[model samples]
Target: MGRWEPDARGRLRAAAIELFSERGFDQTTVADIAERAGVTERTFFRHFADKREVLFEGSQVLQATVIEAIASAEPGTPPIETVAAAMQAGAGLLQGNRDYSRLRATAIAANPSLHERELLKLGRLAAAAAEALRDRGVAEPAASLAAQTGVTLFSVGFEKWLTDGAVDDFALHIRESLAELKALTGDA
Candidate 1:
């Protein structure tokens, strides 16, 4: 790895995760990540705001993907179903990155601050989804309920996807979780 490498961003992300895993998130610093990635602190800053940002850089993209799916869903689709489909679409971003996802999850789970940050990220995603639903003419409580449920479904499904080594389809896990939710609500 070199400072001139084409995937400096990718290298920085990988290095950050690696360092976070080995040193723990609290122990790892931007300088450590930059050194591990063979880049300057300036290069690392160019890629991310801070070490924590490396773990959350994809959040905006994930939210955007979910919002787009919700906006594009067929007219007359149920709110829950639309949000579920949107979450599934968002899951696509994590496909083929299971190993990294698992490592990232581990790192986040180990640190209280990281866990709080993760929760905040999920909250933002849900809020954005709710707004998208409102844009699609979904009513207030229904939009918020569907968006919150969808975010919960996504969280459950993502955990299952990460822990179940044999399963690779994130959407399937989400569908299964949604089914379970429906069963609980007598909607199954």
Candidate 2:
């Protein structure tokens, strides 16, 4: 090899992005990615359950962060406010990782399979957010609505941050987006 490849997870993710971008997710194969990453097929399998997981890496951590943010929020806070607070906490975890984040998101958005996984991640985030709010005794659709709204706002904010080329602070955009979403939903 000309250049030493990255670790298994890194290699897998990079390979996925490249392959998905080139041939589309539906057309790419594990053998293709393994070949590109200079790793064995077993190595790729070790790091990711499938090609889609490579594109959607770190989602488990993200979900945990969003959920933990809500759990760590102060009592009596409104549901949307808690979600915003959690997003701020989670964004701190992603600080200075903008380039990689943008690259990963763009690759996912470029492929239907990855996009579906992205939607599933967002849905899980919403459910987790709602569970956290439910622990706070917020009732019924309020918690569900707030959690879903928060997830949507977070996605909007993240996309804007990636594409707008104007803002650099993910957390600040999340706050602004949450505020906007709240106002739009009459939650504020």
Task: Please write out the lDDT profile of model 2 over residues 70-102, one tens digit for every residue.
Answer: 887888888878887887777877778787787
**What clash count does candidate 1 reach?**
0
lDDT of 1 at 72: 97
> What does the lDDT come to for candidate 1?
0.93
Over 4 Å off, model 1:
1-3
What does the lDDT come to for candidate 2?
0.80
Q: Which candidate is the best by lDDT?
A: 1
Where does model 2 exceed 4 Å of error? 1-6, 182-188
